[model samples]
Target: MKIREHLSLLAVLCSMAMVVLDAGMLNVALPTLSNALAVGPADIIWSVSAYQMALLVGLLPSAQLAERFGHRRMFVAGLMIYLAASVLCSVSPNLLALLVGRVFQGLGGAVIMALGIAILRVVLGPDRLGKAIGWNALVVALSSAAAPALAAAILAAGSWQWLFLAKLPIGIVALAASIGFPPSNSTRSSIDGVAIVIHAASAVLILFAFERLNSQPAMATVALVGVAGLARWMIAREKMRQVPLWPVDLLANRPLRTAVYASVACFTAQSAGLVALPLLLQLGLGTSVIDTAIVMMFWPVAVAVTAPIAGRLSERADPSILCSIGGMLLGAGLLIACFSPASAGLSPYVAAAVVSGAGFGLFQVPNNRTMFLSAPPDRAAAAGGMQGSARLSGQTFGTLLVGLLLGYYPTTDAVSLAVGLGGLSALVASMVSFSNLPRFVQRHHA
Candidate 1:
């Protein structure tokens, strides 16, 4: 890679690594955080949910901001916001303060997450775009692999505050690297601010309803009604706008539709595993925190190993087949996990981690390439927005669904419920995968 390209890639890796690390590390620290802050279990849950909610609300607006200001500018700005939030979190004395910082952290996270890829796509040019994404995914896989071990070490030495503090230097380095870089060519759009608000509101309301529906059904019903009404109004208002935040034409495209569906199903399945597996090890097989960390390492370790392999294979064949295979493998792995005997110990979890991670590794790059390529060059911002929104939306729903299941079922049944959900998601994704069957068969013949 040329010097500029190398720096650009480094900049993205630095920012993304911190984001992924923070996510994994926080999970392990939740117990420590709850006790220190005198928070109820319910409030402690917000430490994660608040960030996701911020990301959910910020997606389209972040895209619009990128389009209006510039991707590089937004990238730097996001790092600063993330840094500030991390500081707030490290020092927070109460549940509400931590939650507030977390929400801000999500806003920062949303800014960089999608735009990082979008910037790489532009800076690297289309020919090398797939490889760039492959490398980016590789970094994510490696950093994610390190997170659990790193978190456990930090917790061992000090308080959970170190989890937030750990990101500070990385964030600072990212900000510095980003600022020193030469700016990419600016692409501006006349953004629809009102539509952005409506879209954000609609997403927040819907997800909130889903989160609340079981505990407070009447309140949830009201929220659902409000969400539906807002959604209807948003669509109507968008029709009147010149450039809606969620463009109608882009979404109505067949390929974009396929990509989004594939994304939602893929992540839904992935999230169920992510949430369930670590807890299963702790709750089911009686693993320690460090042991769970080591076991969970297989997931990102598999992804880091398999991404280049997936990239190589994607060049020789249709990506759809790769996605289908990935979906099937993920499902199969989950099924094996689901049926394993209690005496199976750590083996089932390990198998599931490696297989599902490999599947996700295989599925992500090609699917992302398809989504970015399928959109018009001028509207890459819109394409990136929808793609990010779909992934985030899927992930949010997955977590919410799991929360609901845990609420309704016995605590002892958590793993079983997760397994059931994973199996169902896989079956649905497989049916979707058949859309690529002719290509899969032809590739085999060749």
Candidate 2:
């Protein structure tokens, strides 16, 4: 790659690492935040949930905003908001204050995350984009791997506030880097603001319903109703639009449709493993917080090692087979963990992690390559929005599945349920994988 391309990748890596680290990093700090603010466990959960919701709902709008205004401007502005929010979070005196700060952090995070892949598409050709995405995957895995240790050290040395404080300078550096890189794609006409609002509203309602389904069933019902109503509105609005928020024609396109479905399924299984395994270790099996984090490390470690290899292999053969094989392995790993429950020693859980992680690592890169490249160049930003939204939506759905299982079965049965769901999702994803084989071959020739 050229120096500009290398620099672009570096900037993408740096910004993405900062954002993804925050995903798991906060889980480690939850106990500290709860104690410091004297907040209930329920309220504290919002810290994480709020961030995820903002990212999910704000994604398409961020893409549209980036296009209407400027990618460079939006990126820099997002960094500023992230930095300010981090500072606010560090000094937050009450639960409400912290939650408010987190909302902004999530919004800013949405902007950065949504644009990263879109920006990469502009700088790198299709062949190189896979490597770029591989590196992006590396940053994600590294962040997940590093967040726990980093948060633990901060909590030990200072307090929970330091977690937020630490992210501030890094955000500033990313903002400066945004200045060096010029926007790659030219801007389009004004995006349909009504479509943006309709989608965002529906997403917020759906996610809120999913997240609250276990604790507040009544509220979940209300949220789900809103979700249904808004979804209807979104569909109606899209039918009338010249260009919808989620492109209708793109969804109808055979390759794009299957790829999106695969993205959702693959991520659903991946998210379930990430969320459930740690809970199984710490809450279900009675392990130390640090030890739980240590066990969780295996997943990202495997992903980091495997993604580049997957990227390399994609150059030689069909990505569909790689994806199908990966999905099957993931299902197999989940099944292994389900049947073999973790004892207090953590060995069983570690073994489970290794299997599940390998499956996830195998699936991610090739699948992402297929999704991004499936769309045309002009739609890259929208494709990025779809990619981010699908992953978040899948994670949201995965969390809901786990919650529904826990509601029926006891907490101890959580891992087994997670394993069952993982296996089922993989099976469906594999079917979709078969459909993709010829597409990959055709695209190779094209």
Candidate 3:
């Protein structure tokens, strides 16, 4: 049973780690790709944008597809598509080819991520799902933190193609293991292509608006207004359907709604901190790239250390308490960071990173467990889709905040503002998580 648990997790979660690695490494390699392809910065950025847009547009739809077909088949097909796209990305000779490959890669990533929770519930059952989530969180946190460092090392030693190629061996093994895994039950249902298109349109509009906001405020505002209208329409349309692609039914449950709120807040805090810290260290403080990387590295290390432990604790503990404490720890860490003296060395910054990362791990494991398990088993895929959506939404908003801040202020001031907002978001997460306490606990407090 233990061996089966380990193998099942590896077969499923390895793709997640691969995706995280790919994202981080590809981000670091963007400048190199720009130079290699002889494209301007504007053109090169489209590669990342294209991937993100595709991922966002495809995520929920992929869940529906998985439900209609079989989850196991969809997952295996996603792995195949992802691997094939990676090869295309690695061999591409032109910008257009790479962009096309990235779009497909993003779609495949969406499929894998969307079904992750559902698959875990199936393979591990109720007994082990919580720990598996912790392990999953650990894998993502570690891979995300390590990706840049690994990319830097690899780029120093060899070609950028290696970044995409690195996941191949792991992909092959997961594919093989996937073939042997237990079959998944399919929910026979029709997919609403129109609804998918509408949701994708709204997401794209908002994403494009965020990107354009720093450069074109009037256009961005207009796009945002359009997005709001589309969002309203989509919500009304989906709410009437028995099982919309948007997970509207599951979201109506108070526990799940609260979980999603806290999930978004936690992600917002992490995203804000991630985007701001680099600018703070490199541009504002005039620190070296290597030094900045080292100090920032500590945060993920802290996450790595805390995630599995938190996972174990989540099985028997109150997630509300764990999540509330986790959010505050992250908030406190970021608060400490914003106050760092300009003349101080890296130690203080490292301390902040460690604290923040550890806090993130604490909040993530239990929060995700709640998010995944809150839904009825039949709707688990939808819950998983919503879970991913919440994360992406939070990250987008957090990044948008940083971009807006940078537009209005200098590096130091912008980072400070961003950090402050991140801290505020973390506190909100803590408070919302605290609200998830049992009635007796709430009444006692009241």
Best by TM-score: 3
- TM-score per candidate, chains pooled: 0.91, 0.92, 0.96
Q: Write the per-residue lDDT of candidate 1 for residues 1-446, one digit (tens) a residue.
A: 77777777788889989999999899878888989999888889888888888887887778777777778888888889998999999999899899999999999998878688787777777777777777878988998778877898999998888999988888777776665455745655676767777777787777678777878888889988998898888777777755567656677766566777888887788778777776767887778987787777888888898787787776676778787787787787777777777797887778877887888888887777778877766556667777778788767666766777788887548666786687568656655755756755776899
Q: What ranking of all candidate models by lDDT puts the best one first?
A: 3, 1, 2
Candidate 3's residue-wise lDDT over 56-99, tens digit each?
88888988888788788888898999999999999999999999
Runs of candidate 3 with Cα error greater than 4 angstroms are 2-4, 440-446
**Per-model RMSD to reference:** 2.9, 2.5, 1.9
lDDT of 1: 0.78
Ranking by TM-score: 3, 2, 1
lDDT of 2: 0.77
Model 2 TM-score relative to the real fold: 0.92
Please report, in order, the local distance difference test score of every candidate based on alpha carbons.
0.78, 0.77, 0.87
Please tell me which model should have the higher lDDT, number 1 or number 3.
3
RMSD of 3: 1.9
Please, what's the RMSD in Å of model 1?
2.9
